[model samples]
Target: MASQAESETGRPRYVPLCSSLLPLSRLTLIVHGPEHGHRIISPVEGCRRLYIRVNGIVQGVGFRPFVYRIAVRTGLAGFVRNLGDAGVEIEVEGPAGDVKSFLSALRDEAPPLAEIAELRVEERPPTGEKEFRILASRDGGEGGGTIPPDIATCDRCLADIDDPKSRYCGYWATSCTDCGPRFTVIGALP
Candidate 1:
């Protein structure tokens, strides 16, 4: 029998993968890839995954950029998108600790005007994704779904707007995935 270390180093070496058996359950799989011009299979290929929904005043308010920042910071791989009904959806894959931290930050450090009334989370098996992204908003029934009220601009974005060289300089609409405006638009108001 191969010892843990040797077994791990060999082809198809095992690494802990996430699963639904438990909150942070680990699984193993055969990873087919290359090492020094040869194919290698990693035994430990399972990793944890999460699908989270943040509801209430989350759309149109820089939520995607905010989530992107967090994902990059936490070294997570997943995607986030806006929902027509004024909600946000996120899917992440990474170590259990990082995933949990990302969720916590989603609640505590969201954009200033982002009022997250409720956050729902579910864990699943990792899908072997390489990076995170922001997906287009989902279609909501008819009439272009109900867009939420445009949110008040955020401070970070505002500061960026003031920077002369900033790409968004002087731009009235500056958002960072955390806050901005949504829906609540009809005709010009001015």
Candidate 2:
């Protein structure tokens, strides 16, 4: 990156692209081709972790499974679990672009039952993990929110309940694609 203040002062300053910042005088700038208008390679690629803590009605709503699906699809390796506080924790490691895509999907394509109130992310050094998994839940810091008295019946479930031809219509206790009290939004989708 070029420094605005340094450029204004006189000679422009440049930020190191990789590492081992060599003096500007010793480094040579080369333009391979004008047509190559995109990044040919990632500045950094390797095991890197992003710690994400999601706060909301994330428990019992297929949130962890949802996270697993996206992580695999995004070609990432990490683990996800629910906290005792009705929150979710995830650690993803992979190419920065893929990790970024996973984050976007986490926000944009959550299960119908999930209501994300907050998503906190932190950066950590790589652990060189090779697989993505869903771990068991554990107690979280301090007191946390209580599980809802009951997860609200979702729209799809309501429809199923209302449909005369639908098998779940009469069954007061139902577990369908969208209602598990919280559904198992399968591995591929919600």
Candidate 3:
């Protein structure tokens, strides 16, 4: 006899019965019941990989660096990069628990300038990667994503402008990761 259990997801699970309950007279016992689902459990425990695509005001606002820092701090291994004009793409691989935590932090701790519109996640096979890296921007897509509006100079940039020793000292075009020119700077070809 085997005890039945239900997981938190309301799925039925099985647990082994104590050996004392099984008498030597019974070499094998078979129990048949209604089919619940086709879920198969894996015996091995290890890390999982996830591919995440984030759409919206995720570019030109230090989103890539934000993700890279988060991944490294969380002990994850993978890469993050700009997806042309389609937002950003990230591939993260780590222990299942760590990966989940990283994902949560990614959403909660996004850069101040980032406005995430949509986030899609998909499972992927582990790539056995040991370190996380920031990749170069990729091009060629539908390119219909929203372009962020030009942001006013932030306090840091203002301070940099005021500091005599700063490279941007007294510079009128001072800018930084969180604040700078954006859509307004581009001009169409005639």
- The TM-scores of all predictions, comma-separated, are 0.59, 0.62, 0.73
| Stretches > 4 Å off in candidate 2 | 1-47, 146-170, 180-190
Q: What is the lDDT of residue 38 in candidate 1?
A: 40
- Give Cα distance to truth, residue 21, candidate 1, Å: 21
* Best candidate, lDDT: 3
The TM-score obtained by model 2 is: 0.62
The residue-level lDDT of candidate 1 at 186 comes to 45
Q: What lDDT does the true structure give each of the candidates? A: 0.66, 0.68, 0.76
The 10 consecutive residues of candidate 3 with the worst lDDT sum are: 36-45
Candidate order by lDDT, decreasing, is: 3, 2, 1
Task: Summarize candidate 3's per-residue lDDT along 32-113 as a digit string, tens digits.
Answer: 4456343333221246789999988888788999999989988888999887675899999877777899999889998888
lDDT of 1 at 107: 80
Q: Model 3 misses residue 72 by how many Å?
A: 0.4
Alpha-carbon deviation at 84 in model 2, angstroms = 1.1
The local lDDT score (0 to 100) that residue 55 gets in candidate 2 is 86
lDDT of 1 by residue, 67-133 (tens): 9999989888889987766577899987778887888888888875567777788876677676889
lDDT, candidate 3, equals 0.76
- The top-ranked prediction according to TM-score is 3
In candidate 2, list every pair of residues with a backbone clash.
Answer: none
